[model samples]
Target: MRVLEEIAIEDLGVIRTARVPLASGLTVITGETGAGKTMVLTGLGLLMGGKADPGAVRPGAERAVVEGRWDLTRHPQAAHRVDDAGGAVDDDGTVVVLRTVAQGRSRAHLGGRGVPQGVLAEIAADLVTVHGQSEQLRLRTPGKQRTALDRFAGAAHAGLLADHRAAWAERAGLQSEIDDLTARAAERAREAELLRLGLAEVERVDPQPGEDVELGALVARLGNAEQLRQAAQIAHDAVAGEDMETEGSAVHAVEQARRSLEGAAADDPALGEQAKRLAEAGYLLGDVATELSGYVADLQADPAALEAAHTRLAELGALTRSYGSTVDEALQWASDAGLRLLDLDDGGDRVEAMRARVAELDEQVASLAARLTAGRRSAAVRLSEAVTAELSGLAMRGARLEIEVTDSDPGPAGADHVAFLLVPHPGAPARPLGKGASGGELSRVMLAVEVALATASDDEAGSVLPTFVFDEVDAGVGGRAAVEVGRRLASLARSTQVVVVTHLAQVAAFGDTHLVVTKSAVDGDATVTGVRAVDDDERVRELARMLSGQDESETARQHALELLESSAVGR
Candidate 1:
């Protein structure tokens, strides 16, 4: 069994330093109002990584520290989580948890290593369950009610609920995909048609790479054929004489200079070098003249080829206007459009596939939901009978708890809507927990539910129930009802640890271990609260104080002694 071995609180609230030792069975904490009994629970909460408050620190203290040691031999999941957080478990199967609050900031530590506060919270869920007035109110909510029923059904219902949840999620995803495809059907068709038209236009032209640039140069040359021929003729005459006898040409002038230089070559060797250059220049002039003549012969104005080039350019230009600013850009657009068309065309096939999957998931969800409903309905009958019997012992003799599991639309939790209906008397019509039960009655009913759930856990032999802490579970209850609440808590403690913060003497007498929180002025002015386990005479005095207003009253002492005796017999 999971056990909170001990809790130590330092500088927390009015309690300066208190070490509260816990026990495996029922441990009851009681004190006068404002005497700081709740501080015990506050420390436990902090040790469990509950939200920390700097204001909770005692006056003049820098920080508040709360620590707890737990025996986790029976709680492997909690030990595993601690191990995962880098915490070491002792050979005796104990783990120490620490929480410190300072300057409005909180920190948690597992064993000796510092860890995230959330890590402590995660492990705490497997170690303790704190029930207070708020939890009773939560019992009235439909979600909590459904959860309670599912929990009562145990693993069979839980497995089916898990399966249904998976199927529901799959169905939801497939339906969403189908809806998107259907919604965009018209848009996809439009895109496909546009892509097809663009591809066709690009294919019709079939333009080659860089062809437009080459054609531009060729067209310019053909358009200026006559001017080019005239220019070539002038250049030929300047380089060489039109005929061999022509004067004032470069070839005749160079030859005359070459003859004069050769005559002076015998007297000056530099003149011989000049004559050789002139001879080479005349040869180059002859070659140019011949090439210019050949160019003039070949040059012809061909309007047909020019017209064809212009027509091809116009076609490429038309393609560029709609698809791109250039032929290359248009080609790229066509390539991309072809790929996009394939995806758009596949939308229909994708929608059909998703519809088929959605249909398949729908069947799976229905089947699982049906199983979950059947399981819950069957478990509900047992749960109702069990809780009704518990409520009878808690001072509601004829009250019956009716669990109503009705069919509803499939959801993450399955297709059943469960509600806890209470029949307050034998002949009364069963009504919902909120409308049918009084405050005290509701508290008793919640206690009964807890007892039933704990019993269910015991039968399963799965994970053991965590330590239960109830803050004034007997609120609005008195007389024999208070005693019954105590008896129930004591009975629950037989299977697990139960710590109840209470005020009733009848309840306090039933505790196997009793802690009394007392307030006194210390150091002349400072008020301090402290908790200590009381037994025998001290326990009776404490109970006497609870029964009346004075612990020394003979009448109250007698009642306290009788309560202790009766509690012994009851247990």
Candidate 2:
């Protein structure tokens, strides 16, 4: 029972400012062309977050604004969303929505807080559904026709559709996995072979951490062994006297100097200090001589060990060239290859698993699709019967609607191809709505379908539909057909709010509340228009104006009165 309580439009098109009060039943807005009746629908669109046009602003105005107040006690989902967006609902369960268009930009506000325009659009989806001439064009599309049928089918068909969609998604996922695995099978096999060869080589070598570094040092030492031995022998000779020659050796010279200084130590204390230093030098020289002799004895050039070190280093170098620049990097490659090899080995198993899952999903999708087709077939019968009944009252007697559900390849929606066929008269060959119905007939059929869907929704959910706004629903219709369209709208209004913009006197007469848009010059001679509710004799005058060119025509006024009386009786 969501209701639009009020709408305010300012500086939009030809209307400076207008406050339109809405009621619970049928409200028809009527006016002559260029009187700003369409502006009402435009304002409503703005309140619902429709795209704003800068050209819609009045000449001197900087911007345009449209605001609406809604009673949302019955729309808990919308109320919850508002609360989630940090908006407040009034104590009486009402919310304010405003849309402002300025300088090619549009802004939306919920309650008192600014919100994204999409937020208002989301709320509007559950609050109102606007049907205009464009919808008539859409009704001719097969997809739209199918959607209408699903909507009319209510929750049962929706459940089946949901199930079918889930199964289809599962099947699609498995099929994608299978395709990927199959396409890459040969490439993966090659990758696995390379990884296996690398892993085997690394395992055969089995190099330890830092092993390459130790081997490099050993090789350098072995390569320089002969040079090192010669250098050591020269140093030993300089530090200590050679076995056969000791006269000029450093140790003997220091010993003679120490003896000479000891004899003179008694004469001067500085000379005693010098003697002690020379003695320390002699002792250090002796220790160096002993170590030198031992080092020369141990310094045998081992060519075999040197050759082995060189050979081991060459082996490590070969491994580094193929795998990594260093031993650690080569080891890291081996680790990575091992993991990759595992995935490559499991590819066949994964493909088999996907195939099995795909088979399972195929079964589930087929079963769900069958159930969906059955449900649609059942609902199509009820929908056809209901629309047919509605058409009979819309002045199309004996015009039967047939909803044909046929089998098609399974898709996201299901396996049923739903079409609406029209049999214009008894025994008349049934044809698709697009071919069988004229423009006026199609309009009536659309209206009938809406009425049928609304009724079906009410019966299935025990809930009222949203506000239904029909912009010139009686288009291409005249005479009793227009009157019947009005009557149907009036009847739909009994359950929910219905707003219609029309110029037909018969349709306007059936309104529970009638508003007329009038245009005139103001104090400064500027033309402006606004909407106001008209009733009693004023309503009769408005209706008369619609019926004929003159509002004061005696015959037209009489006819308006009779139309009102007849409408009341029909109600």
Provide the clashing-pair count of each candidate structure.
Answer: 0, 0
* Superposed Cα deviation of residue 397, candidate 2 (Å): 1.1
Q: Candidates' lDDT values, in order? A: 0.86, 0.86
State the lDDT of candidate 2 residue by residue for 367-431, as single tens digits: 88888777778778988999899999999999999999998777999887888899999999999
* lDDT at residue 197 of model 2 (Cα atoms): 91
Q: Residue pairs in steric clash, candidate 1?
A: none
Error of 2 at 90 (Å): 4.6
- Where does model 2 exceed 4 Å of error? 83-92, 110-120, 201-337, 457-464, 522-529
In Å, residue 274's CA in model 2 sits off its true spot by 34
Q: After superposition, how far is residue 325 of candidate 1 from its true place, in Å?
A: 13
Can you give the lDDT of residue 424 in candidate 2? Answer: 92
Every candidate's CA RMSD = 8.9, 7.9
TM-score of predicted model 1? 0.73
